[model samples]
Target: MKEYIVTKHAIQRAVERLGQTEQHAPHHLKQLMQTAFYQGETPGPNGFIRKFYDHFKTKTRLVVIGEKIITVYKFPEAVPIPFADEVAQVIKRKFAKSERDFKRKERALSIEIAEFNVELAQHRLSYAKAKSPKVRESLSDKISELETKVGRIQFELDEAIKAFNAIKEGAAKYL
Candidate 1:
């Protein structure tokens, strides 16, 4: 329902680029401008609003400033880049492998840490029940060693998780 002032330049461009006759250019341009507005416009450089309309097998790009139609021209078709699909597939595979490796390492480290915790618990129980100070000290040493091993494995798991997250973030840019 908004009014638009169709400029002579816009009519001229439609006549030249869209093959419309000079007599009919204004009407045709007005119709295309309406269609473009209905479809919505994207903000262009230098305060221009750019819109596109496909009519009778022709794709037209309309440029406007405020409510004035500035220019009308054909929208160019995109050309496909060579090997783009192959490159995408390769990148996807690399990220998948990295994710799987991280998960596998995490699972293994988690299992090892769990086992060490069970051993530590058993050593603590034995230390509590033992009468001799020597036996209790020995059990205490074993518990400390197991705890150290568990800490080291947990650190490795954390590092693997960090590395996997970095790879995931890097892969997002490409895919």
Candidate 2:
């Protein structure tokens, strides 16, 4: 996220230019920058003139010194959202959330796989030691069922990884 400081002079000018009171100007300016759609920039000596459109659709130009806002001027025209970084934050946040969910699922699946392995081993031991054919057959059936479940879980884990990787890659491209 872009960081900036609001100066006293900037606050005064914003009040004057925006026709706002002293109490409202600083608060309003901060809100505008937070949700502002960045328009364009003009480079200058210490910083640049960063343009933006507030939530109210008011066109605003900020004179920035270093990371501080030095002054503000309001224009009559409306500015549209054009910054990729703005959309990038939303996309990145969505993917990050998805990634967390996928990772959680992957962990759960891994634990299930381990549990299945233990069950399969127990069934294998029972089958080997069983004197009766029926007992051996029952153990065999259970082992097969557990194997199928394990396979399904593995497939799902693979798909989740693929999705997480795809999102990561796609987000990186925009960044």
Candidate 2 lDDT over 46-129, as tens digits, reads 456554444446777665556777788876555655986689898878888988898899999999999999999999999999
Candidate 2: residue pairs that collide: none
lDDT value, residue 154 of candidate 1: 87
Q: What ranges in model 1 sit over 4 Å off?
A: 1-81
User: What is the Cα-based TM-score of model 2?
Assistant: 0.52
- The TM-score measured for candidate 1 stands at 0.55
| Candidate 1 lDDT, 31-112, residue by residue in tens | 7666563456788877667654444345787776777878888867678879989999999999999888888888888999
Poorest 10 consecutive residues of model 1 by lDDT?
49-58
Q: Give the range of the ten consecutive residues with the poorest summed lDDT in model 2.
A: 47-56
